[model samples]
Target chain A: MDRTIRVLVGKPGLDGHDRGAKVIARSFRDAGMEVIYSGLHRTPEELARMAVEEDVDVVACSILSGAHNTLLPRVVECLKKEKGTEELDVLVLAGGIIPAEDVEFLKANGVDEVFGPGTNTQDIVEYTKTNLKR
Target chain B: MFSGYPGGMVLYLHNQIIQGLCERKRAGLARAVTLVENGSEHARHILEEAYRLRGHSKVIGITGSPGVGKSTLVDSLIGAIRERGDSVGVIAVDPSSPFTGGAILGDRVRVRSRTTDNEVFFRSLASRGYLGGLSRHTGDIITLFDAFGFDYVLVETVGTGQSEVDIMRYAHSVLVVMAPGLGDDIQAIKAGILEIGDVFCVNKADHPDADRAVAVLEAMLGLNRQWQWKPPVVKTVASQGKGVVELLGKIDEHLEFLKQNGLLEERVSRSYIAALEDNIRRDTVDRILTEARLDGTLDLVLTQLSQGKTYPAAVAKQLIGKYLCAEESDNQ
Candidate 1:
């Protein structure tokens, strides 16, 4: 019964830079959450599918490869498609070098929260802990 | 408003949970698994509802020492199974960090190919301090997957040293994975692992030491004349997806061998008995511990044991005599 909040730390698409994703994954673990690290180069559909299968409260990914505009929203869209928009109760967040101007765009397109560079890992963890409804 | 009627509310929740399970809903299965893993108050009702819906999926256990490519082999096997038009459910168990009580389940990441495939359902589990090498609820969760109607329910454990053989009671057949250059390490575990394997797979077969590993396994098997079905040692390079199809075929052959000899029924019986025993222990011991805590007897017993006035066995006896016997009679 030591189950705390479960989170999926994903690396979506041709992003070989998993350093940020891994760092957040470790941070989440340190924050006492069970993390499932979906390793490098996963498609958006795969991440969404993993989110549903894992029954995780949060699905957070890093997009340092500059594909956040398409990849982040697509992950949300895919989860909606697979689990139904109304039934999918997951918080989709993105981080890792997202530009300041486009942060609002990502959130508007179903990204629950967006964390860019120079953000604190603890802040991200706290955001997930507070925001996740599951 | 319904909180005023407690029994009615529980009944309502029970029906809702059971209905979700019968509809073959993934969310339903996931929820039931969570309930069972946490040993929630609703867990028994869910299992009772699910137990009758089993017997369709073949629970196959894939186990080996760590770093032996078990995940890659499972991924390859998933592809081979799906090629023939069957769905698979995977349960990958990893170790819980002793310090943090959290785990980074990296095994599921390797099987990324099957993630979006509608036919493959993947779940990651932490061992939860169950030294038996799998989650304590692994059997119950397997029941949920089986009830959900997958053709193959594949369970990948945290690998074995010796005590990890509990998987045999849950899985219909076990695939013991090995690789090249493990030296005499396999020899060291011979007594514990030799009896549990139905199929021995030597992964990394492209390596030069592959043949030697296979020979060692086969020679070990040769020394055992008691096996009705002599386990076959198959070679595979799991990363390249080589020999995986053949490996699946070998597993199927073992499945047939088990069925023809009526061992499959025995396996199922053993699985249920194991599940029942675990549930009984949880219900009995957990209730005793909870009642002791509530009644302040737990501290009293600890004080007596620490003072060395009573041995450990006698202390356990006293607690059971006080709380357990009375509770049993009250239930009757």
Candidate 2:
């Protein structure tokens, strides 16, 4: 059976803010993908294990506590170490409170994309589609 | 002699009953639905078996503010559908207590008396304080009916604002029932319900200001036609069954239009994809949270972060490193 692309949407760390995560989840739903939100305050390890177990094609983490720099690298490392040999094909993305310069820096260290506040939901949906395995 | 497994007789009996349901038996389907709605474990197994056999029912969801006469409106339309020789399945969702998870499904009183008629199947669901203001299990029940070969399945919900609007995702066509006095209520819900409806109904059209409400809806539609799908508005006095025939006609018309225009196929395929993805995601996340032991540490992390004792950024990095990448050995 050709499985649908599964995505894990997690708000890692102390970010109590979930409105953005929810909107993003809805956007994905509207775009016809399954989104599992890790609810609020998921640890990066928790998200990584979930991605592997759920066999998700993508892991999109939303962070607003100014933790993109600290959290992004660890998420990437987790995906590579635990799931790499299988070539499980995971794409890591981040959104919320990200500065412009950090986008490039995070992308260099394995973050595929960074969306700031006020980013249209359409853009997020497009990004997800583009990143999924054909 | 009893089977070795516990509850074996119950399962065996339920299977016999559900087998009759698969053969298009009404007694079995009705009894099965009642059992599931009551949350019986045996009913679940029967429903699962029945679901595998049923297919090809168009599920329609109708929701609106209380007193909009949704039940009366649906009751009237049921006759029209029956006249057309199509078997109909109706599921009405009513409010239940958020605390005790208790509900009173009173609308069944109106629908049950007509049970002797094989053309109609009526079932009511208890919303039971689910976040979306509809029963969590309502979708599954609809699926069971779909498998049973009903031509159309109707889901009625007690309106509770934005979340109830989510029902449109599960419907081939969504009818947002409104009344004459509820323009302000419409304004309140416009954010959620307005965008999703395929057809809008102004029930209680016999009232003095019915036209005024219709006019308001017309203006609302004028602003909303920018989407790929533009919903149409209809007026009805549901209590008296006035306009119900016309309403059914409109539904048929829309169904034809949607099918010919290719909108129906697009909608069903899109919703199916979305639902499939959601299920995978939910199952995946649950596995990680449960098996990776993240659930145990999650509370402590939250407490520390909330108390300002830990930096969220640093904590996030550590989580991915320890739990996610530790298997790699090098990363750890």
Q: Model 1, A53-75: lDDT tens per residue?
A: 88888899888888889888888
- In candidate 2, position A74 carries an lDDT of 82
Error of 1 at B172 (Å): 0.5
TM-score of each: 0.93, 0.59
User: Interface RMSD for candidate number 2?
Assistant: 18.4
The list of candidate 2 runs beyond 4 A from truth reads A1-134, B1-14, B30-54, B110-113, B184-189, B225-230, B277-299, B310-332
lDDT of 1 by residue, B247-288 (tens): 999999999998999999999999989988877886779888
Model 2 C-alpha lDDT per residue in residues B90-116, reported as the tens digit of each score: 887876555444344446334422433
Model 1 chain B poorest ten-residue lDDT run: B1-10
Candidate 1: residue pairs that collide: none
